[model samples]
Target: MATSISFVGLSCFLLSLCLVCSLKEGYAFEELIESYAESYLTHTFEVSSLFASSICNHSTKANERESTFRVVDKYGPCFQPSLHRSVVPPSLTDIIRSDRARIYSIQARLSKNSGRRDLIVEPNSLGIPIIDGSAFDTLSYLVKVGLGTPKKDLSLILDTGSRLTWTQCEPCRSCYKQSEPLYDRDDSNSYVTIPRNDPVCEYVRRPVDPPRPINLCSYEISYGDGSVSVGFFSKETLTMSAAEKINSFLFGCGTDNKGPFNLVAGILGLNQEDASIVFQTAQKYNKIFSYCLPSSTSSTGHLTFGSQTPAPAGIKYTKLVAEKSPFYGLDLIGIGLGGTKLNIPESIFTTPGTIIDSGAVFSYLPPVAYMTFRDKFRVAMSAYPLIPGPTAAIETCYDFSKSTSVTVPEISFFFKDGTIVGIPGKYSFIEYNTTLTCLGFQDGGDKHSIIGNKVQRTMEVVYDVPGQRVGFAPNGCS
Candidate 1:
């Protein structure tokens, strides 16, 4: 269940007390923008550029110069309102394609092989994928899910970008709606609100309004990408796979903001900005988070929590880079294709900043690598008849009839500490004959490659923000 999108809580403090700042003046605008960006990507580390584009290009709030500290305190997130808009998104065709190389990697990690979740991928009554029916083009990895008073039941997106625990709410101003209304807490027995005396609130930055006892209140949170997630706080009893109840767990009931998504019940923020229940609860028991992404071609992958699993010895372990902590677009780094060394030139690495985005359907690359491969593909397609765009040049299914291989070059990244982050040969290439169009970032190279959920599913990747490190090893996910 979710609260209204319009019902986002702000710490009455920053909004009312602080003087106004403007984006035009440069510094103040840059400060919040930078802070929010870190806040945006802080949770899951998986982000879509569409959010950045929306925030910078389409926002009316971008130019404002001054405001009352009360405004910030009251509003909480100043830029969030303008961010609720349309978000250009990536195609699932590419999403499925990203998984090709990962299958091999997973076999080496978990040791045990398995299938996917029971959730089927078939088209809904509307002829689109069931998951895509929610209609949001933008994805933010919940920046944070909040624990609030007036607890309620909620459904949320388990995301990589945001780390706040939140939920949809009751007793809020205005709100958003979907084909259906927000979640009805009345129907669920699982909601609770952590009281003021609870130790959990100590970790939370309180709202400006002191009386707000970490109540279940959906507040507005905006991402640098110009997308928003509206949710409220509540206490919940989370059950592990084995039915072990993790009591007094605070979480959010996510409500949909704008962008590709029409409206959603709630989102689960896994990023670092605010730290979600997943993080909070994980730490409560001295646990860690890990994931096993599966290729769309095959239906399998697992997102693990606690001490469920760990990477094998000898696999690469790179501490997450924390200095630039805010750009939390997945736990991504540079990869070397075809055995390219870590010290290779920057040109091949694409850029120092890469997005380890789990929500993204595909592993997106900048113009050079994409077009270089596209041209080669085009030359080869000449042998067969091809179509483009609206119509598929070839079927969107894998061409199992023939053997094909895509050998992407290998790459590595240099940490600020002068160490190296490496992605082995298994991650560099992928081949599929069936689908012709999945994802294309255009000739304009994006700042970095979006190492999507597809690649993440292949390994047991641990995102340790406090330690500033990301560890990965092959798994049996695929």
Candidate 2:
């Protein structure tokens, strides 16, 4: 059996040896060291600290509606009740493939000639823990919520850009394997299928679709990466926590679901759509929500609904471009490296606009903007030797095995109205191995850019729909 090595507690010599055994099997240690020295020098401290606190244990205790629950990385050491008892942890290839698929889906979805629409709703509050799914083969966040009358726990991907909330349901024609059991409408007294004629079904209705049975409200959502979820558009009681529940919550019970969901039950859409949980209970929560994404996969963060949990003090506000409906849009103007602004033109960002998304793992910039940022970053890292990236999407990689100390330039984002959000070294670069670290930003093509969750880690992100503004606060998650 091949032994897995974690750099956190291992000695440097052991780590160097393990690199050859684990990452480059059959390679001699001396040969590996010679090749490494000729190309790069890396260290273990920063990389080790990244995984230092990632262990998670499941708790049977019920949490208060207003209180937060534990969050874990789906592929980290802490994710409990492994998806498959004997399945080995996903390899790097799997993670890169899944992440690329997700990125393609997002870019393809946004490239379509889609219009933006807004809905009005009221507000209230509730709290739930959010899991980071960046480790292994997934690059999204997960949330644990209850579905139906008796409430069966389901882990769903939390996506701010998605409009419809959904989960795999019973009688699956085609469904991916999930840790939680498929939701059974027969078992839930609160399950209520919406009528085809009901106005609610019109939101997702296709223009070329023929008429269907009045009682059958069907819905289908497809992604660019060929993932699709099709099933009934229904309503049910959504249990937010032990103390809070939302009645007549609109959601999709996916009967034919297939995709790279990473074994999670379904997706919890948090966009501004009428069918979204944000709007469904808008009156109760006031359309205000906030979340703090933990910096490391081993750490925990939260997703809070309403004003019950106050926004962190000294929070900075930025305008949410109202035109970019269904997405929390922001006017990203510039980028700074080592406290020095890049020479890229501001129009490079303003032309296509940008949206902050929780589902995307890495931030993406326009080609010109990304090139400028990458070039500046490379210059700053000139002391370190460049190496091939672990994935196609990530082009800038460094080998740092020889250095005892490293100095990473601070990267910051400049938004409209001069809101400068600093990106911590950990959030800006992902340590793929003790020998390799890559910048987190990617090339988003010429279309609209995206600010993924990696850069948002450890910061409190407040989405105030009614207020038409987004806020950021640093160190909100400890």
Candidate 3:
């Protein structure tokens, strides 16, 4: 009996020893994998042309002297303090839905067969009002600027797709809650209302049965998601900074406004149009503007107008199809991932062509192109374990909680003029949280491919409107 008891104890001791050894070995193996991931990512960023440009240099921060406004992510910590207490921020799912809605709205607007009735159309002006609820909400970037003589600071959405720069004004019939006080034209000495006979008045879309406010030039703009702004088009002293101010700047003062406009005061129109600040201040800035969208909400980015906008070394230029005026269009020839160039045909991109929008959060490719790109991405990321994303819209996701670092392949956009815009792994995949990350690209459908802000991160996007070309350079901001 004693010998049997002793034997059992010996067996238990041996089992415990084995378990301890296995745990230690497992921890050591985990450490090894983590070390490899870090080294691989460092090497990839160092060697890959997509990240090798001056823009990728961490040493270079955003230049404040020439920058018109410091761009901040709307949902980021830096901008959160400015939001109204009653305002509720959208969730990740809400953001994805709004983004898709915006893309579909763009497709509808561009479609010739679509029976959507027009709202506001300015024939002589750059004031083609784009109506989509997602238009304002999905715009993740905001810039602070002053609109009146006394210089009341206002936070406005910085959008390239939009034309009519507008803000909520006093004597509001209906107004949504905003971070700042509404602009009162009565308070500003520089405020000038447009007359009915002015050339700019032609830009205001006339309703079937016009409701003209006598001598005042009134405009009505609506979004698909049930957001609308109706107000008078007028000119005021536009103040960018203390050193920068433009007299007789054309903009909309929304007396009646309602929408999911978040906490923003208004929109900063950067489109190719007479009403856009780009064209309005053309002589001073030469219709050339460049901006760097921040990679994260905690960080800061820059938006610079005119010749002062920095064009760092290794900047690539691509032809802009200005025929799609309100939207900045470019020819997307092909796409490449890692060592392999994607098998998608050029016709896929050229059908409706591609437009790069600053308002959007995710890039949308055609079905075939998106699938091929997604499949290739999956294969390249096969080493990492697959995981479910926060939303169904984002299909490609990975679990990196166990690992200290993540290694992803480089995604490159090949343009018609051989201007290759290389997207680094960090920019290619969005880290939803510490544990999960998702591919930044989405299927935009057959109509048109839209390049959203996600892939444009870290690079300085230069829109040379007069030059009729768009340029991409590295290391524009932090």
1-478 per-residue lDDT for model 3 (tens digits): 9999999999999988887787677975677788766444321332122212212222134445543788877766556444335433454555567776667666666666543335332111111123442333453787888888887788888888767788999988789888778899899988998886899977655334333475778777665565667888889998877778899988988888877676788888888767788988888999988888876666667788885533566788899987666789998978887634688889999987999888777788989999999998898788788887787788888776666555677778898987887777778866555556678888887867888887888788989887889988876785
Say which candidate scores most in lDDT: 3
Residues 138-209 of candidate 2: C-alpha lDDT, one tens digit per residue: 545667788998888887777786778889999777898887688999999999988778899876643233
| Candidate 1 lDDT over residue span 83-148, tens digit each | 353323324443232222221122212122322211111111001122433332322221111222
* lDDT for predicted candidate 2 compared with the true structure: 0.70
Comparing candidate 1 with candidate 2, which one achieves the higher lDDT? 2
TM-score comparison, 2 vs 3, better candidate: 3
Clashes in model 3: which pairs?
Answer: 55-474, 55-475, 122-203, 132-223, 132-224, 133-225
Per-model C-alpha lDDT, please? 0.39, 0.70, 0.73
Cα error, candidate 1, residue 368 (Å): 5.5
In model 3, what is the error at residue 430, expressed in angstroms?
2.9
TM-score each candidate: 0.51, 0.79, 0.81
Best by TM-score: 3
